[model samples]
Target: MAPIQFQVGEKYFTANTKTLTEGSAWFKSLFSGSDKLVLKEDGTIFIDRDGDLFAIVLRYLRSQKVPVFYNKIYGHNHLLYDQLLTEARFYQISYLVYYLENRFYAGYVASVKVEILGLDHGVDVPLPDRDDDTDVQYYPQWCRKEVYVCPRRVAVHRGNPGGCGRECRAAQGDRPLEYEDEWVLKTTEIRTQTILKHNMDSVKP
Candidate 1:
């Protein structure tokens, strides 16, 4: 059978009827038997949609596979994926729509790094332990109190000398504190991270 010719936007595309019908319910109804499809004067059916994205849809229909839309330097081509998603929904391609939506949620964090700036030892405070049922308690004599330098706040952690039985409690301040010799200093860093699930591989086609 002759391929169906389509003129979408300012581009042209050609696909066999079998591939189109199998990929989209919209296409299946459009090409259903005995119904004559109107065509432009040049014999190509004109579609009021993006031609470039339609080409990607056609390729997926033919191969049942999609290329990885990622770049090392510029990161994932989110714009392209968004465009393809719109095209797939317009075409009523259920599988393609599912695939693209899953890909959107399949982001993974490639790497992470942390840096330590400075350290200071603060004045030791001695307290008697008559522990109430609180989540944290510090033993007497050997307990060390440390203040953390944060971006906009300070956090104080009270722990035993051996770094055990430590509880981190946030201490809000007007501004970031500088490293001081009298204060046992640690840096508190807050970072936003994206965690990838182990089942991410299931989304692969």
Candidate 2:
């Protein structure tokens, strides 16, 4: 296979499509003779990633393992770590992504210093855990349809004979982070608390 030139993160990189296709479903589908993706003037692809992360990806493709260079970098930089995770997921390199996320989440848990108040009652100090399936059956949804369309508007009666239920849409939600689903994947088995994560680096000192 010819090397496909790509401009990721506005940097140019030449990569073998065959190696990429083997690792990523996204790559296989994109380059599988489908004309949906447009090529560059130089007959290459233009992906929206910066050339930086792809460099690590290329190294992984060559070695078939997470790059050694990634360890210390994620240890010191949270922002870049998140960025690398996004790139890894986009490329569908589950092995690389799994390790990166485990590293990041481990760092996050070790550094978690926030004080959480007991929100056993339905108050906002710590927010209630809305994930319980019972909440959807007992409460009225606090919704303003004019703002946006939410799927919670519909209700289904599940696991009860002659029982009816309505959806509950509370404004304050405690859903997992964007990468949390990846973390919760049974194959990845990323052990973590259900609380949302935050980075101190994001706050101005």
Report every candidate's CA lDDT. Answer: 0.59, 0.52
TM-score against native, each model: 0.49, 0.44
Clashing pairs in 1: 122-182, 122-183, 122-184
Q: Mind giving the per-residue lDDT tens digits that candidate 2 earns over 61-180? A: 765644332232133456776787898788877766776777634433333222322221233333234441112112223322122223342224222222322332242146421111
- Regions of model 1 farther than 4 Å from truth: 33-38, 104-205
How many clashes show up in model 2?
A: 4
Candidate 1 TM-score over all chains jointly: 0.49
Model 2 misplaced stretches (Cα beyond 4 Å) = 68-75, 104-205
